[model samples]
Target: MAPDLPVRAHARRNREKLIATARAAFATADGTVSLEGIARQAGVGIGTLYRHFPTREALVEAVYGAELDDVTSSASALLDELPPAVALRAWMDRYAAFVSTKRGMLDTLRAGWASGRIATPTTRERITGAIATILTAGAREGSLRADVPPGDVTAMLVGVLLSAGTDGTSEQTGRLLDLVLDALMVRRGPGT
Candidate 1:
């Protein structure tokens, strides 16, 4: 049954708090933090945690979904506020940060994906669509190469993340992302 107004408002706050705590825990822990600890860290009761997320997998999936939602949604918003190439670069930087945060959650995420608690296709499509939107804008504005496919760019990003693994340094990731960004930019005439 649906909760009453006050109860629903309280639940929403608790859920948001839980997600915030989980994000920090997953970003720093070594993939072994407990759900009870997460609840305590969020300052919520165990029952409240279970009310929002019945299982560890559920909580992990929610965190991942929330991250993906933010990154994907920012693509268009960034484009509106900046040039296409700049927006794409900004989005890529955000994506790299998300990937770094994801490293700590790798184990739980892998298990969740294997158990079908996490839906990979939807996530993949959403990310790819976001890249496509940015690339489409870049092409229209003559800032990025029109010949390169968005899927190719998405694949490249996935490759970068996989290669970075759990221990890649920020400098290393920045250089790698710069390479990808360089590849996507339109070729300029020499000294023109």
Candidate 2:
């Protein structure tokens, strides 16, 4: 099958530049980066940024979605490059780091909500699906509990973020999740 070369090519470049700029901004600014900053960094006009994302929420959505996409991609890499347990553990740790950065993103999302910016449900769903895929693989490989749902793991991780957004929460959370996973491990019956 053939497609329109020029139009598709231009769109792809714009999208890639936007995502790259957003990632750099997050890395440097740690969620304090502004929309105009992203536009300038991406070498696009504010109008063009608006054409792609009419509101701040739209831009934040792109950043969060891109981060999740990275996480999902890492899952595949970890699976291929490491054992199931190691990969899952690495994924969990990365998820923790993401949660730490996401606090500021939530504020942006709230502003977007107040300003009538539409939420991107599809992005959220894709992230959920990616985690589920990786978790299922880990469980099947006996590195994680089969009884646990990927959605549940996501919820638990998120819960940790909410509960410990301050006052040494991250420190406690790592230990808590470690214990939970330990308890949830599948053990043989007495005679099995």
Candidate 3:
């Protein structure tokens, strides 16, 4: 059946509300929170929530996917607005914040994985691709070292984010990111 144009806007609004509510609920609560509670918090009926997200895994994935999209999509815009290296640093900072938020979902994600509901590769690829985009721009601009592999940088960033999200403070995370950025920069031989 085709969608009713009149209801489409309403449906989108409800879906957004549900995703936002679920993100907040998952962050505050340990492990899986009730779908009914999420629907109630979203001010939508359980049927609506189920209609948008048939399973808990679906809801979790939607919330995480939206967050990933927001972070990754900024790369191009950042590159357009700032110098390559500066844009890359800003993008990495956003990525770190995204990881910090996602750290709250570790238990839920593991549970989903145990049940074979979430695929790990897709998430990894999406993030790596985003970082690659920024790194490629920096390489092309000669701001970052041409020989440094973007994938290697991505893997190291994963460690930084994991460490920061686990116990390190934001200030420490910023310092770690600065160190990574410094390492990525092309070294100048002699000043004119």
Candidate 4:
């Protein structure tokens, strides 16, 4: 059992290292990046990478899935640390970063989707669910308007991001996110 445990731990570490390395490579790569290069950067042999991810598409899918999971799951974590309105704003930043990262892998992702090699993810639903979670909490706390639908917020955010484009400056994106947050926030009258 002890010997098996070490091997499993080592394999887990290798797998995580490969994924992280691949994610960085994909995020910065101008075109198709070599899988061998990813393994070299991760300090693992090419065979190890193949053992963990049988194909390039598999690795891309895994990286995409990992990013999606992080962005979606961050909603609850942020809400725990900050006010709902603040958390929602922070989540928008995370989602924007996630979108930016996809730029490097867009070609491969599009090809995979067209070829049906990669399973289509329920991306919109998951994103909407995360927004709903934050909005529900904010509404309960009277910080956000309860009348606004989460799907509308998602649509508006997508529009803001699409309009900004991948080259959008942080200041511009920040201003847009602020506008969205302001729209969702409950306003108070002067002098209570």
RMSD of each: 2.1, 3.9, 2.3, 1.5
On TM-score, the stronger of 3 and 4 is 4
TM-score of every candidate: 0.91, 0.73, 0.87, 0.94
Is candidate 2 or 3 superior in TM-score? 3
lDDT of each: 0.88, 0.71, 0.85, 0.94
Candidate order (TM-score):
4, 1, 3, 2
Q: Which stretches of candidate 4 lie over 4 Å from their true place?
A: 190-192
lDDT of 1 by residue, 44-107 (tens): 8899999999988888889998998999999999999999999988998998888788877888
The CA lDDT at 105 in model 1 is: 80
Better of 1 and 2 by TM-score: 1
- Candidate 1 lDDT trough over 10 residues, lowest sum: 117-126
**Winner on lDDT (2 vs 3):** 3
Residue runs of model 1 more than 4 Å from their true location after superposition:
1-3, 190-192
The residue-by-residue lDDT of candidate 4 on 14-62, one tens digit each, is: 9999999999998898788899999999999999999999989889999
Q: For candidate 3, lDDT tens digit of each residue in 101-160?
A: 776677767788888897653766777777788888888888988787778888889989
Tell how far residue 20 is off in model 1, in angstroms: 1.4
List residue ranges in candidate 3 displaced over 4 A.
1-3, 27-34
**Alpha-carbon lDDT of model 3:** 0.85
Which RMSD does model 3 reach against the true structure?
2.3
Q: Across residues 1-192, which tens digit of lDDT does each residue of candidate 2 receive?
A: 257888788867887898788766765564477878888888888887888888777778888877877776777787888766667667778777776666666777667767667453454455566667666776787766777766776677677667766565666878866765665466767996
Score candidate 2 by TM-score against the native. 0.73
